[model samples]
Target: MLQACLNGGRMRDFHPALPFTATEIASDAALAVAAGARELHIHPRGPDGAETLEPEHIAETLQAVRSAVPGIPVGLSTHWRIPPGGLSRQEPIRRWTTLPDYVSINLIEEDAEDMIALVLGKGIGVEAGLWSVSDAQRFVGLKDAAKCLRVLIEINEQDIDEGLRAAAGIQAVLRQAGSTLPILMHGDEASVWPIYSEAMARGFDSRIGLEDGNLLPSGRMAGDNAELIRAALALAPR
Candidate 1:
């Protein structure tokens, strides 16, 4: 399914167009869904535009977005920057029952396994994020690889060519793993469209949004999440 990453780890200082408040995220979620996104991925932010895992903020954000686009699967970011690690952040994962349909976990983080276990225990899907080929290989080595809810292969790069190579390397690792777990591939910045096209060609689902790029494939500043979604749909394989 096509998922829209409304906001990521970045602050508004980096991209003023980023949706920080619940109202803005909800509005963008509605627009993205209308434009063909079947799922949503959001990173809730506090008033100062920093990421947060506070139950109240998460609850309000999920409620607002889900209310606008009913039944659409909404995922939350379990990024280390928000809650860091250890017993303290455990409450956020436990409190997830109050909000979110799924939560994303970075394979490179120290507490990735614990977080994954927590999410699975709670009956919530885990969107395992692999930023590099090594991360993918590490994930493949895990005993519960197939048990994951979903895997998102995020190619991090500023240049399109390099991103394509990175994605290719990740696919090779997955092939070596000898498993057919559901995979979603996408890239950030200048690599977004190139890797997205590669995803379509490689027969994998992909994602697009302001978190991936503040501008459209044409390099023009996107007016909203829907605009980015429309641009991505146009590039999907026919």
Candidate 2:
């Protein structure tokens, strides 16, 4: 499956066309689906244009995007610092009035296991985000690890060789742990296309969008999320 990560915590400075408000995000959702994205992932932004977990902001964003792409699974990031306050990390999640189809939780974060159980109790699917081999090892020990919708192997290493090695190491850990959950791999900045290509070659699900990078595999700046999706699809093995 090819998921479209709409506008991760990116600001307008990162890409002028990056969506922020509910309306813009909804519009992008439509275009991205049309471009062949099977799933959607986003980071809802508040009025201040920062990633937020405020109930009102989450509701508004989810409503708009789901309306735009009915039946398509839409997920969002559940960063531990989204609300950034003295409140417990799970407080914002508890206060959420509207929830996404699933949420991506980084395994390296504090309270990761507790957060997974909380969201699972709420009937929300979990996308375990493993950024490194250690994170993957940590995930293998979680009580509800097998219940996750998928494992998102996110590579941040800048060098192509290092990034691929990082991905392989994580996969090795998961394999040894006997985890059969589906896997989705992606990368950030300079590692984006290379890791995405490798993910496709390995027949694993992958994603791309403004959140990952503005440039296509050809090194040209993408016009929008749709363009990025198209470029990614073109690389899939036929």
Candidate 3:
């Protein structure tokens, strides 16, 4: 599956075209899906143009996107940086009155286990995010690790070689731990295109969008998420 991470922690300062409101996100969703994206992941923002975990914000965002693209599988981020009390995913998970089809939880977080348990209880699927080899072990050690919807192998290393190496290391740990869940892998800005191509080469689900990076494989800034998805599709093997 090809997912589009519409707007992450990225803001207007990073790119003027980054979507902030529900209507903007919904428009991006419609265009991206039309261009071949199979799934969506978004970071909801507040009235102040800052990332937010507020239920009203999430509901408005989800509702708009769902209305624009009825069957698209949407997911939200449990990023700790959003709230004033940084490093707390549990708080948002606790406060959420609205839920997405799934949510991404970084296993490197302090409250990873508890938050995962809570999300599962709410009948919301979990995207076990592995940011490093250590994170892979963290997921493997979970009580019902296999029950997660999918594993997200995210490489933050900007150096292409180092990032690809990081991806391999995480994958090795998961294999050693007998993890059989499907993987949705992608990389940081400098490594995204190469790693995305690698993911496709290995038959793994991959993603792209403003959240990942603004650049295309040719090193030019993408016009939008739809253009990014179209470029990604061309890289995939037929």
Candidate 4:
């Protein structure tokens, strides 16, 4: 599946077209879906334009985007840095009146297992984010790894060759651990398109959006999330 990561933890200064509010995110989501995005990934923002895990902000973001693109699975980031960890990070999720279809939680975080269990207990699916071989090993060690919706093989490495090597190492760990979970591979900035193409070539799911990059594979600046999705689809026909 090609997931659209509409707006990550980026501020408006990062990109003039980056969506910040519920309405803006919803509109961008609809456009992305129209351009062939099957899933949605977003980072909800508070009134101050900062990423927030507050229940009200999350509910509003989910409602607006889901309304705009009904039937497409929508996911959110549960990165620990949002509230800087501890009970404060988990409390807001517990209090969320509206839940997303799933969420991505990095396995490298301190309370990752607890967060996964908490969200699962609430009946929300999980997308385990594995950034390195160690993170992948950690994910496989979790008793609930099989219950996750999928595993995100995130390559933060900027060098294309190194990024692919990192992805391979992470996959090796999962394979050794006998994990049969789905994989969604992605990279950021300079390596985004390369990793995405590799994911397609490997027959794994991939994603694209302003969060990962603002340029097309040809190095031209993309107009919006929809344009990015279109370029991603053109990489390989499904």
Give the per-residue lDDT digits (tens) of candidate 2, residues 130-180. 999999999999989999999999998899999999999999999999999
lDDT of 4 at 113: 95
Clashing pairs in 2: none
Model 3: lDDT equals 0.89
Report backbone clashes per prediction: 0, 0, 0, 0
Residue by residue across 1-238, what tens digits does model 3's lDDT show? 9999999989787677899999999999999999999999999889887888888888999999999999999999886677754556466667777789999988988877877888898989999999998899889999968889999999889888999898999999988998899999998888898899889988999999999999888999888889999999988888
TM-score of each candidate structure, all chains considered together: 0.93, 0.97, 0.96, 0.98
RMSD of each: 1.8, 1.1, 1.2, 1.0
Model 2, C-alpha of 238: deviation from truth (Å): 1.9
Error in Å for residue 185 of model 2: 0.3
Question: Which one wins by lDDT: 1 or 3?
Answer: 3
Give the Cα error of residue 143 in candidate 3, in Å: 0.4
Residues 63-150, model 1: lDDT tens digits? 8998899999999888776764454676766875466788888898877877788878888788889988888988888776788877
Worst 10 residues of 3 by lDDT: 84-93
Clashing pairs in 1: none
What is the number of residue pairs that collide in model 3?
0
Ranking by TM-score: 4, 2, 3, 1
Clashing residue pairs in candidate 3 are none
The local distance difference test score of model 2 is: 0.92
Ranking by lDDT: 4, 2, 3, 1
